[model samples]
Target: METLLQWFDLIGIVVFAFTGVLAAGHKQMDLFGAVVLACVTATGGGTTRDMILNVPVFWLAESYYLWIAAATGVISFYLIRYLQVPMRLLMIADAAGLAVFVVIGTQKVLALGHTPAIAMVMGVMTGTFGGLIRDILCGDIPLLLRREIYATAALSGAATLVILNDLDVLPGEAVVAIAVLVTLGIRLAALRWNLSAPIARMRSH
Candidate 1:
């Protein structure tokens, strides 16, 4: 379980770093800016989660997290320009990161002896807050604030994981896999179909 979580964490870091690099490139940021954004995007949610949980930050304890983020940032900075549609890549990468992070976050919180409610909240936070931070740094409106199904997808996945764990419906690995698939499916479907939550409108008196 621990090994699987670590691997998922690494995958999330790489995917989120690529999204951050793409954001920086869109803003015409230099390599240094790209690297900075990538590191923040890759670890921002986990750092926030650790602080909230009163645990030591994961990246500080393991320097390899930073190294991976940095290397991914550098590579993405050079490679993104070659792509015809960088936004598509960015969205896919962000969805993948969201899927992984939600499952990892749920497991970590559960392991730490937190309640399922707290675990679900933390899971959603872990999945979406990095992208929130990334959008803020890039001066774009955060996806979480938009009508998009961004955070909704995270919430659904986290809820599913917590429910499954509580019910003992499946093994740990199967639960994580199902949760990730749920997140990714919702997110990608939203993207593909242009689906979004409905926005409220006020009538002028």
Candidate 2:
């Protein structure tokens, strides 16, 4: 389980890094700028979660996450030109990153003997903060502030993992796998269907 979680963490870093590169490309940033953004996006959420939890920051303890983000930046700089639909790619990668990080966050908090409620909050934070930073740096509104099901997906996944943990109905790996799928499925469905919560507005005379 430990090795598996490590792999998911690295995968989340890579996915978020690519999404950051995509945001940089949209902003006409150079390779260095893209790499900086990628590293920030890849690690920002995890860093904040660690600090809040009073645990070691993940990339500080495992430098491979930084290396992967940098490498992904360089590779994406060359490949982005071939991407015909960068927005779609960004959305997909962002969804994937959310799924992976939320699971890791919830698992980390749970392993630390935290309650399910705290785990869910950290899971959503870990899943969303990187994209929040990336979007802000790109001069875009953060998706978490939108009416979409973005955070909902992460929350649902966290709830699933927590409920399954409490129930002890499956192995750790199985529970995690189910939770990840729940997140990814909801996000993908939202993207496919343009599903979102309704906006609230006041009538003005």
Candidate 3:
């Protein structure tokens, strides 16, 4: 389970970094700016998770995360210029990265013997914060603020993992897989159907 978690973390970093690159391209940032933003987008949530959990910051403890972000940014720079990527690619990447990181964060908290509630919060945090940071840096409205079922999807996945694990209904690996699929499915469904949270108007005084 631990090994699988590490691999998921690495994959999350790569996907988030790629999203950062895509955002940078949209903003017309130069290479240095793109790389810096990519690193921040890739690791921001995990770094916050570790810091609040009082664990070592992931990139600082292992250089691979930052290196992967840089490599991804550089590669994506050329790929974007050559490939005719569609507009929705970023959304797909964001959904994937969100699912992966949510599992990583929730499982990490559970493995540390924390309560399921805290684990779920950390999971949502880890999933959404990186993209929040990316959108803010790119001068766009953050997805979390949008009507889309963003953090809600992360929360759903975290809850599924916690519930299934508590029930002991499946192996840990299976739990993780289901959690990721649940998240990815909800996100994709929302995108496909233009689903969103309803905004309520304020009551008159």
lDDT of 1 by residue, 1-205 (tens): 7787899999999999989999999899999999999999999999999999999999999989999999999998888778654578889889999999998998899999999999999999998889999999899999888998998999999999998898996888888899999999999999999999999999899
Poorly placed runs, candidate 3 (over 4 Å) = 203-205
Give me the overall lDDT of model 3. 0.91
- Tens-digit per-residue lDDT, 1-205, candidate 3: 8778888889999999999989888888988888888888899888888899998887898998899999998998878877866769999999999999998889888988999999999989999899999999999999998988998999999999999999997988899999999999999999999999987779999
C-alpha lDDT of residue 142 in model 1:
93
- Superposed by TM-score, candidate 1 places the C-alpha of residue 16 at a distance from the truth, in angstroms, of 0.2
Question: Which of the predicted structures, 1 or 3, would earn the higher lDDT when compared with the native?
Answer: 1
Q: Residue pairs in steric clash, candidate 1?
A: none
All candidates' lDDT scores?
0.92, 0.93, 0.91
TM-score of candidate 3 on Cα atoms, chains taken together: 0.96
After superposition, the stretches of candidate 1 with alpha carbons farther than 4 Å from their true spots are none
Per-candidate TM-score against the hidden true structure: 0.97, 0.96, 0.96
